[model samples]
Target: MFAKLPLIDYQPLKIIDIAQVYCTLTHPHFSNQIITDIDQEINIIANKSQITCQQSIPKHEEELKIIAVVKQLLTNLPKYSYPKLSLKFKRIISLPGKSDQAIAYFQTDLLTDSISTDLIGGKLNLTYNLNSCPLYFSLQSALIRQQDHRLLPALAFEGEFAYGNKDPREILQIINNWSEDWLTFKEIINQGFLG
Candidate 1:
């Protein structure tokens, strides 16, 4: 139902390959983390919409809650395996139809990896080889496990990996750096502790 809506500023993502029992080419943790975040937002939206009609209060509170939840989810995510990211994203394919401008492909692409880091979130900092716009991090998330069960601090979110930077030059650097370890890439970009 929320397929066409753009709740976040970025393009809407389809949380495919949730790894019920296994995974394919995609980075298991990163892909699942992305899915977790998206589903979290969906849950918030659904809950608010379900009860908003019953209550007279505006949905600003629910929106804030959703944001807070996302932040916490980010905080709880575990770090990525650095070099493993580039290898995992061996390929990618997107197919967005009219009105439904969304990506519907899996595992494949042909981009030279570069690297970059950002001080966007204080000192935590994220580093990546920009191949698929990586955004690595570390966390202990209480996310849903396989078999529809649950687990505490299950190393949710792949910790790093986004779709591409807004700039092509910087994006190039990010992708090119994917061959290096997280520590090397971190030092190259001068973010913080790379290990």
Candidate 2:
């Protein structure tokens, strides 16, 4: 039998307090040294084996613009690391017909892709039915290269916490737990696929 993970105590926080976060990590081979200043909200880091871009306060429309900028930067590079891309966004949401007085938890596998004798990649959709509302979480990852659909390295995760809740302490705790689990899962993927 396996032991269950310990849950953290609830700490209330306003939705606005949680800044919108975006992260992208590519394979080492695709890493380059060209850095372009996009804006104050965006931060770019270029290393020998990877290029990472993080948006502090990301907007829906800005996603496309960011991707375009990344593509343009990639063009300047002479070589490509198998072309792996990962995008993640997190925000708060609201659900109707859900009571804030109930406690529930649900999760399911949304999709999966694998290779022989190994779990290559997949996605998991989760819902936390709380007393105030339901929080939705979507995580998607793959090891396939975007250019030719060949296997590479990639991962993404998005968590949407329900808004309009009277109390946020419980929700914050849930988010904390989910984030811890996500970190562990990411490490596994890093070792298995990106390593």
Candidate 3:
């Protein structure tokens, strides 16, 4: 014969523990590996879509969207100034090439090579000098919003909030309100840019 035992529950939970509980219970183990796998899959899908769109020849469906975002950012250029700002970019037409032909607005500063890697978007590695040039920061906002590309302008950039400065989100909000479209701008270039 066996005796019946009582089931008692004893646990400690904090005020901010509810969300954690929900996330853990709902998502389960799903370790970092799983998360990385899922993220990679989604990225692959998005890259495919972007490639398809890019390769669609002169079909300018999203042209206005890009142009509007760029112009909107350009409109607010006179507001702020960043002395260390430098600009460089390359188009990933089936793995960006290894050359300096695409360099824009500057002669000496060149994009010698580029690669597709897990670190950055098509890894646009470049070699240039850091002279005391008056490179504006607003362009980053424009570029970020223009391509709507994920990842910050710089590898070390952490969103728009850093070193107790103005919140990036707030600046973006101001831009969004002023732009013709409300909340349509999804990306903000130069996320880590600062004076």
TM-score of each: 0.20, 0.32, 0.17
Candidate 3 lDDT, tens digit per residue, 118-175? 2222222222222322212121111121245532221111111111122334334433
Give one digit per residue, the lDDT tens place, for model 2 in 1-195. Answer: 112111222123111112222222334553457554566655667766556655544334334344444445555553443233333344222111122201111111221223212434445576657453454655454232335654333234364434332222332343334444334434433343224
Judged by whole-model lDDT over C-alpha atoms, candidate 1 comes out at 0.26
| Candidates' C-alpha lDDT | 0.26, 0.37, 0.20
Which has the greatest lDDT? 2
lDDT for 25 (candidate 3): 15
Give the C-alpha miss distance for residue 159 in model 1, angstroms: 4.4
After superposition, the stretches of candidate 3 with alpha carbons farther than 4 Å from their true spots are 1-67, 82-86, 93-195
Which pairs clash in the backbone of model 2? 28-49, 29-81, 30-81, 93-163, 99-131, 100-131, 100-132, 101-131, 102-131, 143-152
TM-score of candidate 2 against the unseen true structure: 0.32
Q: What is the lDDT of residue 37 in candidate 3?
A: 21
Runs off by more than 4 Å, candidate 2 = 1-37, 56-64, 92-195
Which window of 10 residues has the lowest lDDT sum in candidate 1?
Answer: 48-57
Measure candidate 3: CA RMSD: 25.4
